[model samples]
Target: MRDDEFLAERFEAHRGQLRAVARRMLGSAAEAEDAVQEAWVRMSRSDTTHVDNLGGWLTTVVGRVCLDMLRSRRSRAEQPLEPEAPVPAAVPDPEQDVLLADSVGSALLVVLDTLTPAERLAFVLHDLFAVPYDGIADVIGKSPAATRQLASRARRRVRGARSADSDHVTPARRRELVDAFLAAAREGDFEGLLDVLDPDVVVRTEAGVTTGASAVAKGAATYSRHMVGVPVPALVDGATGIALLRDGRVERTLAFTFVHDRISVIDITTDRERAARLKITLL
Candidate 1:
């Protein structure tokens, strides 16, 4: 075979691995395929006369390309995930794909979205890809200690969210609690809602235009107070509820977490702009 033929064959052999890495980074299968195609083009045109360890070099190139793609795609602060298309029964189940599109997968990705770019990359490489801390440092251009620090913050957030159970409740059970909470919120049922909440249940918000911790607690309380008898409206889907005060319109995003039979936690981020888009009403 000609020299060009050998290179072409090599590309075909490792292309699947490259696509997987790109998909992992990009979070979109279509984008990953496109990135790999572009990488192959760059490889074909380059002067590779002295190139060694083709696979390692290719891996590096693919990772860099993916990082670039991820940066460009970062503007959407809250990424609404697209549902997987229905698969034919004849086709064997795609276990990995199923995992990626399931409730747990969605939960993980949503939590990951809260991390900083550097932190996200570090956590993904270390936890998701099983990359060593030293190598993760290399990819993220941080000292191993710094890399570990980033992962530390990310891990803490994940664990705190997961362990938020006031009572022992599995993930599936917690999801149901969230549904009931949203129902009460929509209907404005403070008594019914508070019934499910521990008297001292924690509700807090991050700083912004909205009132500080004291203020949000009062607002949520007021919501229940005014609507004491009104039934909270039905919440859609009920995966989990996130509230934020939009920068311009609403006072905050009121995100919630559920545990056992009660609403375990409430986190309100005061983003007035997001609130405006969400069209949340504030009394």
Candidate 2:
């Protein structure tokens, strides 16, 4: 085979892994495809004669592209958090797509959206994908210790949102907390809302990020008073949540992650396309 053909074969072998990494980094399948394509373009232009581990090199390229895309999105305040369209298949294996979707559920995506660009990359690469901290530091331009810290903070946030302690939180328990939050919001009870929200709770929306119970409560109060449709209780990506329907279609989705009976994170999306992408079941 010619040299170019050899390079193409190697690139194809790692395409699926690169696409998966991109998808997790960017919440949109379309964007993930773009990132992977961009990586290929860069590799095609560079001289890879000295590269021993092509997979690692490609992963680094994809990560850098994803990091740039995420930072650019953050710079533009109007970008929506969730994106429409099914994530393109990394390979032709249908089973792989199913497994990937099942693994990266909506609840996880919601929580990830709250992380900063550097933190998200660090956590996704190191924690989820098992990339070494040193490897991740090179991608984000941070010291190994700092990169580890970013992943550590992200891990704490993810754990707090989705705790593994099976004893305390049941489906019914989660529903009760969500209902309580709605009740407080509707009644414009700021203190009541705070009572149920974790002290360092995070509320993320298209508008921006709000941290702390007090600030989240203040915004929740306003949202409650202006709510148009009655919210139906539901499970969003296997987590307790709610959906507002209009004309028999989901107009809004509110996904929550709890820690020890208090809400640690709340992800609210009013964008129609984004809400449709979530696995929602009205109760």
Candidate 3:
């Protein structure tokens, strides 16, 4: 294959993930597509013989492009783009991904939206991509320590926002207990489900939206009682069923998070007014 063909193939294979990353940063699919395409164009112009990690290089380029886009988009006074779109409610696999869909989850993306463009760019490059602070300083125009500080600050914000939604609980282990609890709930073994609870376990919903453990208790019992239960609808796979009440079967996409083996949060989205371009199923 020709050099251009090789580049095109690589670009095609990674474009979806790249677009998703850019979209999370810019909050617009259109701009994300543009950023990725621009990255492709820029990469295509470079000699590939010396490029190291294609994923890293492409991710860096896209991150920079997204940062530039955000800078340009502001000053126009458009209503903040509605929080980043949630990952699709259902995906090809489930067993593999029990925790949050991706680090770029809707909640994380929302928190990212609150970041200054410099902070977002710095955080994504160094923290998410493992780009060195020196490398990131070049991208965001900050010194290494400043870059470090920026990412640390960004993480604190992310951690704080997450605390509001799901606490400091390990997202993966939380998925496990949630899965077991849902299964026990389905079996109508209230004792089995109760075994997982810590008594003080507090289930949460979309940050400030709190649900009584009682509701998760009753709802799980009923869901176990009826409907062919599939964990709340979401694109992430193999989840223990976070946000259990979000109703995934009827809606095409939904998401719930579990805390301490009990349903804690539900974040199923139903708005479609701006999503006309994406083929989404509410079922």
Over the full model, what C-alpha lDDT does candidate 2 score relative to the true structure?
0.80
Model 2 clashing residue pairs (backbone):
none
lDDT by residue for model 3 (71-119), tens = 6654442324544454331233464243335555633543444456777
Best candidate according to lDDT: 2
Clash number for each model: 26, 0, 21
Residue 38 of candidate 2: its Cα lDDT? 97
**What does candidate 1's lDDT look like per residue over 1-283, in tens digits?**
9989988998887786676555555556677678898889888998766877676567656766766665555553333233433222122347745643442343344333444556656655565445677766776677999989877756555554555544566655555665566566566665656666643344543331221224333455566555423322222133245432223333445555554455545655445554445533322
TM-score of every prediction relative to native: 0.53, 0.60, 0.50
Say which candidate scores most in TM-score.
Answer: 2
Report the C-alpha lDDT of model 2 over 1-283, residue by residue, as the tens digit: 9988988898999998898788888877788889999999999999988999888899999999998998788666434445554445545577766654554554245434777778889987875567898899999999999999878767667666445355266778889999999899999999999989987687777766676688889998998888888789888877789998888888999988777778888888878998899899988
Output the worst ten-in-a-row residue range by lDDT, candidate 1: 228-237
Error of model 3, residue 233, in angstroms: 41
